[model samples]
Target: MVYITEELVRRRAEHNECEIFSLEEVSLHQQDIEKIEHIDRWCRDLRILYLQNNLIPRIENLGRLKKLEYLNLALNNIEVIENLEGCESLQKLDLTVNFVGCLSSVESLQHNIHLRELFLVGNPCTEFEGYREYVVTSLPHLKCLDGTEITRSERIRAFQGLVEVKRRVWEQEKEYLRRRAKEKEEAHRKTTGEQERKGSKPGFDGRWYTDINNTVYVQCPGLEENKENQEAAENTKLKMTVPDLEEEQRREEEFWHTPCPFTPESRLEAHRHLEEKRKAKEKEEMKPKTPRTLITAEGRVMNVNEPKLEFSLTEDEENNAIVLDLAVYRHLDTSLIDVDVQPTYVRVQIKGKIFQIVLPAEVQPDSSSAQRSQTTGHLVLTMPRVEGEIKVTKGASRPARVCETGRSSSSEGQNRKGHVPERLEVDPSLHTAPDYANIVPRQRAKEGPLERARTPPAASSSSLSDGFEDDLDVPPLI
Candidate 1:
């Protein structure tokens, strides 16, 4: 084993141009050194020392280095951490790969208040239950452990885990003590019976009789020695089994008074009841639900009986097209409106009004186009008509508007001041139109009457116009 001599220390100090008195660091690692010597007396001002990777059995002879801030004794045979009480300035300690087997070994460094980083990886203590927690809780000032920064959550968990480990250990110890006491009691009973049989005397009638007063004297030739031995054994058995018996009785009472008892059938029944409840809930969820009606943001249900918006559907046989006119009175952002036109249904939702119209006949929805009039505020949807009869299927229940002349009733006309006799042209193709439902009128407009009479009356549908004049006063269509 190579030893660190004073001559070698002097030579190293000269080579590094460091004087012995002011030397701040020393590295004697991997020198096959078994013991640390002369360093405390020669280099008293040393601040950092590396004695790792050696066969050092224990940490010792470093108390004189009061200014030491860093110490690395890793990869050594350090079974316990002791003799570190004078390392007041130590900020980092590396004892990794060492044989620190117990928390008490780590507890020896609790006085190191300035220790900020510690490395105990590859140590035997790592195998202990709650070792990390024990170390962290024991050394509250440690900032980093085993190359990882200690966090608050880890600290809290460590404390709780340590408590649980200690509780389990205590319970195990109690059980072991109880078992030992029981074994000792059994052994003591056997010994006492053997002694009594050996101490028995034969009476004149040829029967063996144990005289309690002279039992010790009869068992052994030395009466006092045998009595003392018997008394000591009895005292030991009492000391061992008394507490165990009391603890057993207390535990039994606690169990007997417990409010709930654990049984497999009860647990199975509870699980089955929960499963049945879950299945019932699933079945209830699987039931069909009715479509929800639209409601305003202010909690008022949208009026389906009396719609706020009125629109007209006109079929042009000459052009083979269908025109839908929707009156838009409220100032609305066109970007907010969404319209979906299918072959069988047309859905329009703008602001608060939602309308879905089942078509009287199938139309080409892909070829449909919609345009908004800037001046009149009318949204017009034009769809190419297909050659087919109206299917007459049930549609969403909604207030309907119909005119005898088969013309659209204009909101502008109803609010007009002067009575203008206007004649509306009716399409002959629309005479066979089915009842149209599920239409919501737009908000009332503040505009004058539109020129509905501008278009010339068609000759094919004149009778429908005459019928409208004959029955001019018709109630609102339901």
Candidate 2:
């Protein structure tokens, strides 16, 4: 049982130059065997493809190969041939012993003018009464059938039968065309007679003659005067009952107040309103905020609000999220603290000094302090609180007030002054600051005082590293 899939055969044919390709009896089973899809792309010179005794059900996939000359799809499970319309150069198609019930598939082979031999012996089409007559009439170029030499008597009988059928059909079609042409001619004659009768009468061509005495008629000129008289009578009658005509005229004038669509101030105002609403909605959706903290060297702590900035960042599936390299500087040391820091994506505080920093999806704050060292350099931390020893540079210049990376100039101005500006102008009550200790690096508690509590009087002289968690210091306020 050679269970060769289409993909496997295609991959093998891609590199090989075998002229005769055969997957027959190879246990291939598919309802839709696209010929070119299974064949190798490099098999441009393939001449004969034998896919018989397999499970191909449709023939549409074979139309792509322009050079195909011979195809055998016999004795498997084909139902119809709706897909073989483009095989223009096919010469020999073996479809014998299939379950095809209709002559439609055989008729579609008419476009395959090069087809010389077709096998349809065991199909339902072959057992159909007048089957030979139908095939001979539809496909006039077929020379061989059913793996045998068609006897002279059988050929003569089939040709004679088809000739009589064609003759009868031709007579019916000729009668139909003759009747249709006769009806069309009668209709055209009737139309011409009606036009001639109307043209024989006078006063219908915009010219009126006044017959004062029937013998001496004069052409009544001045058609404009008649129109004016009719209009004057209509106006007088309407004005006698309708006093609201003046109001109708006023409304019509108001309806047509503006002649040019582009020049109207109302149109411009509506357009401006739409543009403003669009910009506001986009700003609301795209504001970036984070909640990471920075530490200052002077020991004077300043909570920095990382303002939401705008930048085009694209994400990758393999990398999971977009990487942003934030440039941090230490004003005290004049050293740049550039790091790939994943922004903190959490609710932000509305305090004037602190802003929000919205990070990309799949990016989260470093939950463990031990894991912070492995973070990539593309990170911008929104510091909730800044404390001593570590000078956190927000902006580029001296005295680095905590600033977010990639913020605009207008937003930078807002962060410069102590009070934070409402760049996004989100509802103040909806924001919440993240836990600062979870994201920010804090100084570990000293062990000198706690060590005294852990050691007994005898063991105080011995060195002990266990029970370190309980030995950590406690704040005076706690």
Candidate 3:
């Protein structure tokens, strides 16, 4: 059976940019999941869960979800409602289109006083006589049932009819239970018989195994969200022939149309079919992918967006550089990314996927720098252009540092107008010492040379010698 695994939960959580421990919402719908497990322990903080359209027969291993507010178990094989009394915050529950026949089992939900909405449409119990009156009176806190609002008058009427309706409901519930017991036995028998004949359960050649209209959509490998049509075309090309293709399709249709019992083996059969398809898909994906033609035979570089990531490339006039800002996934780790800076083009490889783009102008690969943003995760590349002309605006040079002496407020405001004072912009990553000697404002080329700092007047004849002649350093005093 396809049980919920930690790897699946963790992968879904990673895709959502959160860890399992802190995950508040999760969607495990239409995964062909036959059982629910691991999620209660892994996602204790989960508030919303979607487990719709699966083969899950029982609801268990979910009592620890105290924070759970909504649970959707529609289109499953769930026959009874139990073991949900611990969902203290549950406000809504969806069991629509399930096989829930035991109407009395919903009494287990009477403990869930916080439940405001309950959906049981298309279940066997919903067809039972006086189903609505029985359920409305049972779950007094329920405001909506099967998408219909439960008015105050409806509640009072249901309470008035509860006496007679409860007896009829109990009788119908017993009959459904007896019939389900027989189905269980018959399904179990068929499961074992098929297992014995096959030696082991074998997967059928189909994309999905539908039982009682519960469809599980299986995904193929190397096929992204937008590549479904391409994969389908590939599959058609591989499978379609003339005479045998039609015969095979006819047989497949006949097999599915033939009524079959929904049992453990049948549900597991779907899982195994998907498992085999996954293996075949992996084998197909392992074939070497033809890299996009970025460089032609004539040594001409071409631009390509192979990975289909959004990016912007612009000419930075002020810096005389080519700036490329690539919108990468924010949660992507740097270790999984590799960048290659070239004079003609830049290439970035993310987890074996390639994204290469040609530059508009020639650049200096040695002078190029690439950095990722901490918040936005945009990869900004600054590549100094090799052929770009550096245009300098002709203006009077201002003093790098103004050591103002006896200056008035008016003079200070006027002299410093449209001027920016220099500050020590230290970068922690670039381990270099500050150039203290260069801090003094030097005279500009058009300006006259300023007076240099003079030597100290108090320099004595003894210390004036400094380290020039130190009498052999006085026997090298330690």
Q: Kindly report which residue stretches of model 2 are placed more than 4 angstroms away from their true locations once superposed.
A: 1-7, 10-42, 150-156, 163-478
For model 3, what is the alpha-carbon lDDT of residue 426?
A: 49
Residue 435 in candidate 3, Cα distance off native in Å:
79
Model 1 lDDT tens row, 1-478? 4688976676767655857878888787876576778888888889989898876777888887789999999877676788888988999999988755544667778888999999989875566566667778889999999999999998888887777766654454455446545655664564456446557666899645656533232233344367657765444432222225577568557634655422222233344345656886899899986655655578543434123578888887677777878886647778866777777667777774676665655789889999988887778888887667564579896543457756445754576668886556578976975546514333345322222233233346644655454332333222
At residue 57, give the lDDT of candidate 1.
Answer: 71
Tell me the TM-score of each prediction against the true structure: 0.35, 0.29, 0.48
Residue 67 of model 2, lDDT score: 70
lDDT of 3: 0.80
Provide the lDDT at 55 for model 3: 84
Question: Candidate 1: misplaced stretches above 4 Å?
Answer: 166-478
Cα deviation in Å at residue 276, candidate 1? Answer: 79
Model 3 spans > 4 angstroms off: 14-16, 199-251, 261-478
Q: Candidate 2's residue-wise lDDT over 1-478, tens digit each?
A: 1343645555445335422254221222332232325443434445666776654445655666557788888765465655665666678888876656545457788888888888886775564556666666677767766665555566667777886755654454455446545655664564456335334323577433333312322333443358766655544432122215696567447635734322112333344345656886799778876534554467333434454423233444443444332322212121222223333333323223233234444344453111112333233332222113243458766442443455565647756877656454456786889877757443446444444355423335246567643323443221
* Candidate 2 vs candidate 3, lDDT winner: 3
lDDT of each: 0.69, 0.50, 0.80
Among the numbered candidates, top TM-score falls to 3
